[model samples]
Target: MLHYIENSKTQVGKELVLMDIGAEYHGYTADVTRTVPASGKFSPEQRVIYDLVYRAQEAGIAACKANNDFWAPHKAAAEVINKGLTALGIIKNETDKHPYFPHGTSHYLGLDVHDRGTYGPLKAGTVITVEPGIYIPEGSPCDRKWWGIAVRIEDDILITANGPENLSAKAPRKAEEIEKLMIEESAFNQLELPKLD
Candidate 1:
């Protein structure tokens, strides 16, 4: 559910679509990810999870400052997610080994999509990504309403002496902002492509 099959004949419907995209300019590549509701509106339950993930991403981004260890972001994000999931009863307690958040929350970015680094303390001028997510697939242990819900929000952060700077700040992450943006016409709507047989 985190990604779509290439050219799959399926519709997004009212479900959420997660796009993990990367762009290259000159020699460096930038990676970004965003999840949006297909209906341009989020169900109440979906909004809860999305908002929780958003808060977790914020915590992670805050840990992206210089002098922090490379793992600081993931630790901060995981702490928020663990507590949020506990409050939602998705996990029995904060210490429960839940499957909801199963990945690291940050990584280096530069020439390579996943740029190489020492994985040591963060330093000024370092560019990285802070992504936090919660995935509840069908038939999960929790209530049926949370089933098939997956949300991920990623932002590129630059480690600085002052603090972290969001390079992708222009991209909308708020539910209201996304809903507003979705109301606009997409330039791709007019494109026509030949069918491959």
Candidate 2:
């Protein structure tokens, strides 16, 4: 994926686009993507809502435990986001038509981004991402206050007998956490850079 991003720069746009494909040894494949701030630092407003989305993602992952239904994570994540947005003044009411979160909470994740599977009393083996997003496009109602901004957090998880296992735990989703990691990593790289011989 890194090689593709680096070499195929001409094929991509300035905005970050989450695009990746995965294959399992057991003949399963998965693909997912979430656009991020190319600069690696989200604006203040973006961070505020992004954190809520991350929290929702966490809630969804936590709901993927054994005996839970496939829809459990979706419901959990959506509820979390809705609650957070309500508190943040993004939504006037629970059923209000606000653009705060315009996407589904979760989806079937396997060979396809929206994989097909029985979404029922969850079995021991299920994988999905609880991605919630907020897109306030220009000239839109929500855009009046927060325009040209979008935030989303996606994580891959596998249901287990004990609980959910995060497959994409390496990715940082927290606002402060991500910023700190980026700064520390960048400093480390700079310190390791050799002076021009």
Candidate 3:
């Protein structure tokens, strides 16, 4: 979903807002995503889902090291997601297919969001993204209270011999940190953009 969706009616007191965005610097591109509560605060259910995704992303990032295969991070992320979803009764067990999280956790991010890197062993100096998500739209098999909740915490990670370095560290990812930053007044709050047709 690399397209913009217009929803000017969106405002405070909303549920979740996912900003799956990217930027181009000179020629190289960077992909980053930050999911936040629309009301500058998270409801109990939203917080639960958000935290699960955050933990899964962390696990995925931790697995992104030199000598590890590209699938290493995905495997690690899926394990966390399966356990979390199982605890919530969203699934039977960790060995389940894990329908909630159905995407790759890491991918090469450079000239394009999915860079042209060899699908082999990870090496130092490679930059990748760790994005784990849980999408339970309406009509999902989970409890009704868990419906309409989707969250993903993404970060540009630099693979190194030492460990993974989060390039987008300054951007808040935790539920509380995002709330704090959202509460802080922004310059854009004063300026208004013209309505689109």
Question: What lDDT score is found at residue 99 in candidate 2?
Answer: 60
TM-score of 2: 0.73
Evaluated against the true structure, the overall lDDT of model 1 is: 0.91
Candidate that beats the other on lDDT, 1 or 3, i.e. the better one: 1
Clashing pairs in 1: none
Please give the lDDT score for candidate 3.
0.86
Write candidate 1's Cα lDDT for 43-129 as tens digits: 899999999999999999999989999999999999999999999989988988988998888889999989999999999999999
- The superposed Cα distance between candidate 2 and the true structure at residue 121, in angstroms, equals 1.3
**lDDT digits (tens) for residues 1-197 of candidate 2:** 12134554553332333434455646665544454555666666766766777788778878888788777887788888778777876666666666656667667777666788777776777877666666556775543555655666677787788888887777655677666664655555556666788
Minimal lDDT window, size 10, model 2? 11-20
Off by over 4 Å in 3: 1-13, 190-197
lDDT of 3 by residue, 1-197 (tens): 22237656445467788888889999988889998888888989999989998899889999999999988888888888989999999888788775677778888988888998997989999999999899887888878999888888889999999999999998988888999998899888799999999
User: Which model, 1 or 2, shows the larger TM-score?
Assistant: 1
Can you give the lDDT of residue 36 in candidate 1?
Answer: 88
lDDT of 3 at 115: 93
Off by over 4 Å in 2: 1-26, 32-35, 181-197
> Candidate 2 — what's its lDDT?
0.66
